[model samples]
Target: MMFMMFSPYSFLFFSTYMLFMFSLFNITNFYYYWSVMELMMLLFMGLSYTLFVSSYSQLMVYFLIQTLSSFMLLVFYIYNLPSLLTMAFLMKLSMFPFFMWYINLIYKFPNFMLWLASTLHKLPPMLMIKLFSLELNTNILWLSIVLTVLFSGVMMLMVLDLRLLLVLSSIGNNSWFLLSQMVNMFVFLFFLVIYSFSLFFLLNSFKGMSKPSLVSSMSSNPYALTLWVLSISGMPPFPVFFGKMLVILSLLMTVDMNYFFMLFLVMNSLMVMGYLQSVMKYFIYIYSSNIHYMLKY
Candidate 1:
């Protein structure tokens, strides 16, 4: 009876979730990891369009890009081409030059897909990075991280939309993902967990908003909004703070990470600025709107 009530989309969502979990067990197996991620992307595209009919074309293009990347990834891995393999994963993760689709499509994601894409979908390629010990040019890596951080910060300053802020913040966090892996797989996993936990609450809060829109204003729960800001900015008292500390410590212990360390501090300041902008706008909204109610009647 319960199965009978399950929509096709729900079933597919569960299947994708199971496949994601199953892939974790086979995380070290290139073939299994590749196959599972390929399958997951296929399911993800289908469900995304099914649920968000208006964004079908965008979803299809994103699908094709990922499919092509997956195939190229296979060929590169087989040839022991670490450079190509690393590039393939970067494209798959939609970092920098390849990020146009991610920015266009993330706004259209149903909240579940948003969380899945932001957190889980990103994991396998990162896992593969560790599995194969692939490395990119240090200059290229530094440049990419710097660009993502700078872009997200600048964009965040202008956006009032909650979902857009979440997207930009996650884009910036991809730098952390890339850097954490350089530290070690364990630190990488720790960072991912901290990120996922913080993002989940942010998403859940937005999900609770009614049909007109997911407003980030104090019109909703203002207290929750403050927590959301802290979560994104990684202020003290949140595990995000500690996760970043450990990454910084690990990077310091590694040679030649001084530049990255300096860049990391700049990135953190930008994150705080961006998220604080979000919360402050809400306070501004409340004060301006509420200061005159019924005009002393």
Candidate 2:
């Protein structure tokens, strides 16, 4: 589950990507013309993953097959080269600088497609990040994580739009990849899966709401929705709580820079508080409105 050194990580991602994409539409709504663009995006992304992985594997094998001296020399040269490949994969994942495009795209897509993009489309890029992060410089990685988490958290608090909030949340959640590096793969994957489920449940509950809907109308299933929100907020008893606990424990052991870890904790607390406030605001909206007004919308 960690790096999967012996397995073909590429094929696994390719398969998961296909399954998630296919699962988004049932027979009733599986129209070809309606989702032509999305289908094309999936096809292109899948093929790109296959090619990149295959080429990388071939290159590594070629290097390994060479004499030891030649292999070490090649490694030295490669190490000195710029990390363009890594940057490209991160761009595809919509991390940081590349993320604004994704934020804009989510608004144009339907909720179901949004779920697929937010969860499934993220698989290969995540695997690539995990694989590369092991070899990349730790200092650079830590700096990127700190910047992304703080910036995304602040932006999330400022947004009133539901879609933007979700997008920022996804970006903030992406920090779990960095956390995974500190602890173990299980913790990272646990957070990823639980967060995906939270998003899926939340989006599904928004079925009858308007575009740019207020957070107050997120769901009629208030209990379920609240649980999902709290879980994502890293509230206890949820898997996210365990994941964060593991990350914090690992961070304490492996890194001496406790202040950075403290920053992460503070930012997470603020993010969760903002989410609860939004939910409470929704409840107030419900109480203040008439039954006719609620039914009319």
Candidate 3:
């Protein structure tokens, strides 16, 4: 009865999400985790149907891609084929080379599906990395991160869509995730939680609206929205900074390719600030006009 305060759809979605997360943490058997995740994906597909019938095709594409990733997982389980597990997880998350399909599918997704796919659907693979990421070659991970940020920067320059921009922003934040993953085991989990909260806070502000939602929310809660942007961007004094700071310190301990890591740090910083600048442009223009209009009237 208490949960009935929200619409049934809202209640169901929230409940399913919480359950999925709970199971993700508690489950140890690989097959069990895989089965639970597949079930959650099916539930999300059904839930999306209630509100966004038109997104059926995109969701199916997502499901099929995920199934392919799982087949990779099956091989990894059976034969342990050369980081196939890692590749499967990254492919599922649409990181780096696999981002092409996500780019194509993301635009067609309705707002709700976009939110779930970007934020919630990404957790399982992240959990897998936490359990087994240390064995990865550090140089390769950093190189991929650099490439991801570099590619996202070029695309960020040409995109005007808020959803697309946010998706690209995740490309940068995920670099931090991998850094923290390798730097310290618990730190990865910490950054993941903070990053997810910031993203959820940012996207939830959309409140199920179209492209102008950021401006609309800014007009009402400019300070809150602005701070969320800075936090997500890892601006100093925000919570994300501590996690990143730890990673930077740990990175300094690695002597090989120190210059390369420095380049990555600089490029990644610029990539994040690029989005921050765009957001600030909106805030300054919109917030200033709102203030000026109020003062004049």
Q: Which ten residues in a row have the lowest lDDT in candidate 1?
A: 209-218
Best-to-worst lDDT order: 1, 3, 2
* Clash count per candidate: 0, 1, 0
Q: 162-194, model 1: which lDDT tens digit per residue?
A: 678788887888888988988887999899988
RMSD of 1: 3.5
Best by TM-score: 1
Give the 10-residue window scoring lowest on summed lDDT in candidate 2: 62-71
Q: What Cα-based lDDT does every candidate model obtain?
A: 0.73, 0.56, 0.67
True-structure lDDT of candidate 1:
0.73
Model 2 accuracy (lDDT, Cα): 0.56
Better candidate number, 1 or 3, judged by lDDT: 1
Tens digits of per-residue lDDT, candidate 2, 206-271, equal 743213334654667767776777777777898767767777777677778656666777766656
lDDT score, residue 53, model 3? 36
Q: Which residues of candidate 1, in runs, are more than 4 Å off?
A: 1-8, 209-213, 216-219, 292-297
> TM-score rank, highest first?
1, 3, 2
